[model samples]
Target: MDLQLTGRRAVVTGGSRGIGYAVGRALAAEGAAVALVARNARHVEEQAARLSSETGARVIGVAADTGDDASVAALAEAAVRGLGGVDILVNNAARTNPGSIPDDDLEAEINVKVRGYLRCVRAFAPAMVERGWGRVINIGGLAARQSGSVTGSIRNVAVAAMTKNLADELGPSGVNVTVVHPGATRTETMLDVAGRRAAASGTSREEAERRMAASVSIGRLVEPEEVASVVAFLASPLSVAINGDAVIAGGGTKGPIYY
Candidate 1:
């Protein structure tokens, strides 16, 4: 249960809330020094302070838009400076808006999800290479396996491909790269989504949530902490067995046979 992660330094992007926040909490709970990254300076810093106070762990917050290269570079620099070094990088920053092939928002989606992830990995992986040990856990989605939203499918699949390629590139240096795909995670944002669904379905929020939960095999939505726990494990030394793999953390993902 130690995870051998005590004192390990980690940087988690999009760490202000949702799965990102949960990931930071999980990592800190495991005794890792964590620096959380988000686009909102005030919110991220507040969450950082709260986490530090609660866990008594070294935690700092940085605000950087992952869609920008220069910002991500600065993020890497600041994170390394704050944590003394980066042993783990969690690529969790993303835009959750639903897109369509006809909508043709592919370029923008690629920028935020695919290119942004690559940017973070590029910025931090070298340090891992230099230190000869690192962990990169890319937050992907189950849409990679499903076929409905082209934007989601492309972005998630792209992240998975990038993770595999990075694992090949960094595996010799003792850096393990992996991707986690979570579906319909239960986070604060989910409440907002549920509220909208309630309005559209002419149902109560509770009923909307229940309908959503019924779609999952577990009869409920997956919690952010559940996904974060998987991510935390993947970010640890104990995850050496799972390099370049996609671990789905969405309440068992209902009846899909994925090899």
Candidate 2:
């Protein structure tokens, strides 16, 4: 499958590691030029260099905090200037701070996940609309559905609503917008979550990982590349008709229509 992505340009937030890096790599593999955005300059440069070397694709690194409007605006401008224009935008940056119930800051979480997404979309979608083609894939979470145990459930729920809203607004402009809910991915963040769960359960991290897997229908954690594959599909021409849909890439979520 060609994906018909050659010569296209994309910007992926949080592209230094984990799911964001995987999506960047996949897009580069499909022959799209990509600008990888992250707060850490060195990490973003390293990933961009690596992906460029591996796929022989044009990959640029831009350092910016997506949570800040100024930073996000600068990043979007840099991407457009570097790549000519963006045909795809992947909003993958997120933040989940850990603290006691009374100390947790839902506002900070929402600022990064929800506001950051909206800012990115606002900065980039106009270009896509003018071009009459775009792909906007929001990297959502399973917490959007199963909110009971998740600490950042509020942020995820807010993102779910925003995703639908953006999809509706952009769909009429030739931009296919969709959200992907990746469950329990094997990323650094997931490892941190597992560690916390282990300490709470009075068990080892290994045991907690096993328990987490068992909780899901599939007895394993989802790989970042697995979610990336879905992202690639959504960004490809094959998924032009999948707008406004929230697709779950979790290893078979616990409840029906988990999104």
Whole-model lDDT per candidate? 0.90, 0.87
Model 1 misplacement above 4 A:
98-102
Give the Å error, residue 234, model 2.
0.5
lDDT of 1 by residue, 93-195 (tens): 9875632344488888889888999999999888889988999999999889888888779989999999999999899999999999998888888888898
- The prediction achieving the highest lDDT against the true structure is 1
lDDT per residue for candidate 2 within 1-259, as digits (tens), equals: 8888899899999899889999999999999999999998998998899999999999999999988999988998799898998999999987633322222666676778889999999999998999889999998887777756454566767777888888888888899899998988888878888899999999999998888888678878999999998999899878987988789898886547522
Q: List the pairs of residues colliding in candidate 2.
A: none
* Model 2 worst lDDT window (10 residues): 95-104
